[model samples]
Target: MGRNTRKRRSPLATKVIAGAAALAVGGGGLVWANFYASAHESGPSHNRTRSAGAQVATIQCPDVGQKLRKVPRGARAGVDRELAQLDKQITEAYARLASTRQAQSGDASYVQNAILGPLKSKRTAALDRIGTNIRRVGGNTPQGLGRFAECRGMGVDQPDDGNGNAGNGQDGQNGDGQGEDDGQGQNGGQGQDGGQNQGDNGNGAAGPFAEDFVDINDVQPGSRDLENGFAANGEGGSQGSFTAVCGVNENNLFNSDNLIVAPGVDNGAHHTHDYVGNQDNDAFSSDEDLANAETSCQNQGDRSTYYWPVLRLQDGTQEFDAGDLGGGAEGNVGKILKASEAEIKFVGNQRSDVVAMPKFLRIITGDAKAFTNGVANANSSFSCTGFEDRQVTDKYVLCPEGSQVVRTSNFQSCWDGQNIDSANHRDHVAFVQQDGSCPNGFQAIPQLQVRLVYDVPAPTVENGQVQNPYAVDGFPEQLHKPITDHNDFINVMDENLMNEVVDCINSGEDCQ
Candidate 1:
């Protein structure tokens, strides 16, 4: 009992001392926390007060309406920084999109023309090479003897093949198709000169091999006479000199030695002998052939058929006014498909070379007026199906017929206040009559037929090489500007761009 009393009395003091030490330590820690909190929340006194350690610790239950500081001393910045980064990304995206759109929808002809122009020149070069090769081989065909005969007819001396002998009319061997001559004297066997043994083939007639008898080394330099000409071969017979028999096929073929007559009729000189029934060998054989020729010729004429515009005269009928002249002059008769290189040649017997160097040929006196009209006004407008109607100003209307003027009143404005509707804004032309009859040096006509001539870029050269030799054939004439090239040609066709082509043509650079 005495021990229990002694401990109980003293234990209270021990408990009190322990409690005081604990309170002292807790109060000191609280004061340190408050001091740190006050220093951190020093931006402005208007801000809400902070707890002792809540400022640097987790705040599970923050006071209502208290705005938390967005960033701590070392925390990452907020929305503005992120927004800036996002804006940068957005700008980059837009730029990329713009570039992509341009690449996708930009000029097609210009892009294609860059590559195709050189190819066009190469095509001509290939044709020239073919001609050269034909000339080299002599006859229209690759057969050496045929080519030799052809060359001879053209006054081109053919050099003997390397074997030191003029090529025999029959592949080095004689007409008998034999090998080299044997040592059987003048009148040898198959390989021998059979004509020599046959009474010298009557009156010393020159045999087929006679011309070939010249030593190859003795032959002089030959000329390049291989043009696109054809000739026919003559018939063979038991009698007559072998040369005369085989020589029949010397100059009767068509198209650089194409067949035209029956064999043996007159050797090769059969221009008059109608072998295939149709004797007319001007250029084409039949109507179909003529059509093809005409098309090819036209294609070669402008490199772009778009230049030819149909002049529509208001007859209440949708016919093209090709040759409609107010005065009924052949020159002003119908709408002229603007003269193309081939057209110029076909109508005037002029070569493209005359016009190509200057990039244009002078308009014939008769055609000059019509050409001027076409250049001044040709309606070439088009539209897409789904999108707004696009008035195409980049192409021209080609009138296959003559130059006929259409009534100006007939040329109504398709544009009915709809700027984007192509059907409404397509190009239109009206022919104005003079004194309600005809104009100067002309006859009484109903209308003056005009066209919407598109602004097609003309072929050009830079540094002596073709810059845009042919654009319509391909696409996107060239690079630099969307509508113009360095040569000042309106390389693209569009409503706006068509004006450029018209302007250039009006200035006498591209059309006419």
Candidate 2:
């Protein structure tokens, strides 16, 4: 983990070093810093040899130290405008890069020429302009400008370390990936104590799943309570419902490119995921495939792919392992244990009037990038088997002896009823209202909730010392930290099953 003591060369410097031996000295005694040496120099009369070593040219960035001073009021607006333009340019550049794919030639020349090359050049130019504008507004610092340039010039598809820590090339200001400064407080910044027991309305005991334990109070109030079955006549007048169990598809368990987060980059997920049900589920899996793929579900027609980050447990020596499930490879940082059972339940909309979700509908719940942003976007909940009243939001829970640990995720259920997919992957669907009714323009559909139960053993203790506790894989360092785990589902249900589900909801029958 120690920093390398050798002097690090810039990318250009390395290239220069590789070609240094071929440069030639001019008649004026100045060495030409070119990759090729003139052939005429080989003539006997002109064969006077000169050392090929040339000092690497150091590109000097503008000195902006003095620019970080008092500025005129009018300059602020110009600076803001320029910064916004730069941000827009950077975002578009990333989008274009994401659309580029590898060719069959077994070479990445297309990616280099069409993506990374242009991206780096554009980013460098933007950073330079930004630096100049910041200085013009009297708000530039040498260190700040250097960091901005470095991060912006780095390639766009860099991966996170999976420990909630942003890797190099990430803008330090929004390294957590929320990418917006909406003034929401930092996660875990306010509450420190584990037993503070902050409750809904900021009073009384914490609700189930401990809504007060984090800042997710506004995410959707009933998610915790809804873990239990919804009442028959509770909201929008009870509708019919049925639960179909989609078993695990072991061969489909993958660590492929993730289109939701870092799109276009191959294997960008970094962490592995356990996928079930759908046979053709991947970053590039198409609507056509979803409609046709055979499924592992008993219904055979429900081909929806259910996926989540694999869970790993810490062993006796405090090292995390993935057990039998294949993960924690590449740059991933932990081990994992396979869930004994994974269940995907589809609950009919409380509104007895909603229709069926269209085929190939994509639904994403919870923010995968929410780990560092705090628990607001994290929709994960945990509880013990018998002591269900003690549901908590903490990453790792120490269950009592003879108890089982459970992780649950309930996805958004309301749909726009038009588009099967959206550019952002979320605009097509919305959450059901607090009163259990779908929003005006959105239609209510079956809600998908996944539950994984683990019979984790309590940490062994001897002589007042605690041994290994249960830990999930892929996070860096501390095995027990809370994670921003989320889930994604693309409805590949058979047309018949879909029709049946729609009928059940419209009929108000709660059948499992």
Candidate 3:
């Protein structure tokens, strides 16, 4: 996150925005998931949206971790803890902002004076501690940490969504909540309801708004040039793939802690994760503990931990974690949706032969904070079972009667040879260049790809309300935007097994 992230445009998706009509169905409402104010604003500022009664959407703070270039090994743990606290602070601030919508609509200075100001004070202290932690460990403190203390309110002028909050101006539509022509014409009366029933606590804690979903048919087909350079190479290349038969989280190993990014912090993720592979993983799971834990993989040698935010059907079913912090308590209410199949596999890079990855190499694909942090790191893909050719990165795919929902996460396959992990947890590894070659000084490693298939009942939009929708658990501030969906992995394969997997790829053998 500290490093300069390269922007690479691929043939992954034709367009990331929802087709207008795709969101107007049954007055299902619109989701301004990408409409937040800039995070680069110096301090708290009014958005001056379409109306003076504009409401706050989500909190936007400079991502402190993403700005960090490095933290000495001795200071990494403390710095990580501080970074997690920063995220925690944002989550709490956003929750407060969400709950106080009525107040936000009335007083213009309310958010700046109350929410943003207090949040800044708290973040300032945390950033100071991070600097102290670095200096205490004989590491130079990174500059500009203090400048990130200020955050701003991100929102749009919103119609009073009958979802609960009041004083938010008024509904834009007239009669029937049906058809009414305007700037974009009828829109069938469906429009941004300023995020549906955000505080409902039935389907979700905050969101997964009606507009967050789109008809799979509405998405344009995305294309990818699937050249792996194996055939083009005259000399050598790793063309084969390896599969890890790690079942989905059938064991219900769930938690809201992120061991890689937020070690030692409980509920650091602020959302639940469905874990497979390592049986013992939580805020306190040390590398040693993970190494000794039983695994769900068929080949016991693959003890690596694989996890992602748990998908939940907003069916009002009370799950075990209904009262827990990372679960329903934090607005992630719903029936937990277990993936029917979790296809965990490692595939080779395209341009060159791959080298064995260091044991315990951690890679985080996609971005859990992509909702507010922007889509620079977002790579989550969604498609229906049969319509795999058509995928969308922002909208949840609604399948037909018999078709199932599918999620695909492709991890970075390039590694910086030296570090097993980096301060940012991402800088040590990178996605391949647009031409299928690793960046200079980076080597190819087995890229992990996970396909999670779910047999979820199609969520329907009826009379402006979406029913039984499924959304990945996420920070309340993120509003369950599909772009925030992500996957995490830590390489724990035994040295012998790692060597064997490398051999399988280099020898052009796709083996289990």
What TM-score would each prediction reach against the true structure?
A: 0.14, 0.53, 0.80
Candidate 3, residues 1-512, lDDT tens digits: the string is 01001222222122211121122212222222222211111111211223122244567577788888889999988998999889878876765665554454455466677788889999999999999999998998897789989876443222212232322222232111122222222212112343334323363225665556777877666542222221122234677879999898767777788888898887778888888898877778788988998999999999999999988887767676655556655567677888999998787766678899998889998888776576667787889999988877777888988999999888888899999888888899987876778889899998888999999988876433467788998877777878788999999999999998998888889999
Candidate 1's residue-wise lDDT over 328-366, tens digit each? Answer: 100011111221211111100011110011111111010
What is the TM-score (0 to 1) of candidate 3?
Answer: 0.80
Model 3: clashing residue pairs?
A: 1-66, 205-331
- When summed lDDT is taken over every stretch of 10 residues in candidate 1, the lowest stretch is 481-490
**What stretches of model 2 exceed 4 Å from their correct place?**
1-235, 249-252, 259-264, 316-335, 459-483, 510-512
Q: Per-prediction count of colliding residue pairs?
A: 96, 14, 2
Give the best candidate by TM-score: 3
> Better model by TM-score, 2 or 3?
3
Task: Please state the error at residue 383 of candidate 3 in Å.
Answer: 0.6
- Please give the distance, in angstroms, between residue 447's alpha carbon in candidate 3 and its true position after superposition: 1.0
Identify the runs in model 1 with alpha carbons over 4 angstroms from their true place: 1-118, 121-125, 133-283, 286-512
Error of 1 at 475 (Å): 16
Ranking by TM-score: 3, 2, 1
